[model samples]
Target: MTADDYVEQASEIFVLSDSFIRIRELIDDEASTIDDISEVILLDPALAGTVLKLANSPFFNYPGKIDTISKAVLVLGITEVYNLVIAYFTTEAFKKINANQAYLDDFWIKSIDCALLMKFLGTSLGIVHAERLFILGLLHNLGELVVHQLTLEKHTACESNDINLLPWHKQQDILGFTFGECSAGLLKEWQLPYNIFAAIRDQDIDDLSQYNVETQLLYIAKRVMSKNQVFKGQSLDYSSLVTKEQLELLCLDKNMLENAVDYCDLERLSLLAILNPRASMLY
Candidate 1:
């Protein structure tokens, strides 16, 4: 099946709950207030609890307690809160997808690694709404799951386990499109923000000049996660994978990238505990 076919099939099966839809509508409406969004969030106890947990989690590092949805909205801002809500619900929506648990676990770990790195790096660069970058990194590779669900036979062939061979090229060779593009297609179908989907759509490209800063940041984060030898229990090397020009584009140097990777290592486990249902079960 093609990318669109897989996306269409996945959308039919993996559906977002109505509460999230309502929350999106509320965020879009100019008349909606914190209490208005909080009222809708309160109707879903699990979501509300998750929101509070994330507000208190190291993700935000807020000092005081964010005990209520209204307060969470106030502290996290409506857009950041919406970013978290969608990130939460999107993961929840795909929790039970038919795939090997081990494979899925690895996929999610790498995704969270990329996400935390993106958030850290974006924030370091003073980008607004860096939380959305986290969501972008988290959701970037979901098309792999979609493909695994729809066309199980092709899924294994799509993996580029070798550090030298980029996964997107492998996917393009096998599936006629990169998983990033397929992921973007799925997000577009869900009516997500244009920037979110578009960045994912072009993240794997060689050229970074045409895309926005968010997309460039995502591209860098993805490369770090992809080429991370340390994550695979090997020695580190960025000399070949990340170019000097790329680092300069973001006004970042090798040390900052190293710090971002270290930051991800520090934060990945905690964030995964909150985001990954399978991992959360262990706690």
Candidate 2:
């Protein structure tokens, strides 16, 4: 199957939920009031519940639980609320995929970690639309999700454990396109800003000279997340991929990178606990 084939196939399997579609349309139309937006959110009980749950999650760092939708909006801010809505909507696609739970869990953990790290870096850089950057980090691996789903359908006999053994290009070849490319295409189709599509499309930090601070932060965050020495079976030299000049440009250093990783891990664990409230044994 080609990338276009997966795109065509995904269209059939993944219809954007009505609530998400409505919210996206309203936001695109520039409906400026909280009530107008909140009404659209409240149309789907599941989406609303997810928002409130996420608002109370340790990820938000709220002092106390927030029960109401209006309070969630107030606490998380308008951009964050929109991000949560999209996240809740997009998670259904992952749920429908037959990928291994452990792989999916790790992917989500890493993505969330990247999002937290990007948000931190964006704030430090005084980047506008920090929350949007966070959302981009969270959704950056969406193409992977699509590829995994489509591959499962094509290779039903293939075991999950064998997936990692396939070369990166081979995996993409089998699936018709790499996740990075597909994710960019999908986000573009969704009418997201050009920078977001570009950032997701090009995960390489070296190729990000033209991107703004927000995109640069996301690009670096993805590189950090992808640097799994143990999982990849090779020591990733971040120095080679991310030069000293680039780090200085971003106002980052070894210490800052280390601290960001630590902070991101903590946030990921907190969010995981919220997602799996009963998984105390796992923790």
Candidate 3:
């Protein structure tokens, strides 16, 4: 079956909640105030508490405490808070799926590692609203979940864990399409913005010169995730894993690459627990 077939089959299970839909609508509405967004968020106590926790988390590094949804909206800005909500609700949505617990745990760990790296790299490059890249990095591999859910027989083959062979390459060899392409297809089916789905669609391409900076960042972050063997507990040479040309794509240096790796290593542990779907079950 084609990626679209798989996406169509899994669409019902992978969805944004009505609360997130309302939050998106409010963000798009010109007349909406901080109170407006805050009201929608507070209706779901779990979402409200998570928002406040994220606002106070090291994710933002704000100077003072953010005790309420309204304060979070004012400090993190409506757009950023919207992105955080997307990140939260998206992860939470996966809680209902009946997949292998260990596999899901590893999947989220690698995803968060990629996300923290993307945020750090984007922020270092002085990109605006770099926080949004976290969602991109976090969600880039959701197609793998789709494959695991819909086409269980092919999922293991598609994983292609050999370090020498890149993941997208192995996916294409087995499934005739990369997981990134499948991921992009699923996001587009969800009616996400062009900037988002488009980047994920093309992230597996050999050359990223023609794509946007976010796409380039995804490529770099994925490379780092694979090379560092994140959550695999093996230390690899950072310099050897990332090439000069790859770093130069974003005008970043080796030091910045090392720092990004370090940042992910330091932060991913806490975020792994916070973002895991199981953790959200307590809320």
Highest lDDT: give the candidate number.
1
TM-scores of all models?
Answer: 0.94, 0.81, 0.91
lDDT of 2 by residue, 155-193 (tens): 433223222353334444555555666777777766666
lDDT (CA) per prediction: 0.84, 0.69, 0.81
Global Cα RMSD, each model: 1.8, 4.0, 2.8
After superposition, candidate 1 runs with Cα above 4 Å error: 229-231, 234-236, 280-283
Please write out the lDDT profile of model 3 over residues 98-129, one tens digit for every residue.
Answer: 78887787778788888999999999999987
Off by over 4 Å in 2: 62-65, 152-177, 193-195, 229-237, 275-282
Model 2 alpha-carbon miss at residue 45, Å: 2.4
- How much does candidate 2 score in TM-score? 0.81
* Candidate 1 local lDDT, 156-230, one digit each (tens): 887665666667777898989988988999999988899889999999876787779888988899888877732
Superposed model 3: Cα runs more than 4 Å off: 230-243, 277-283
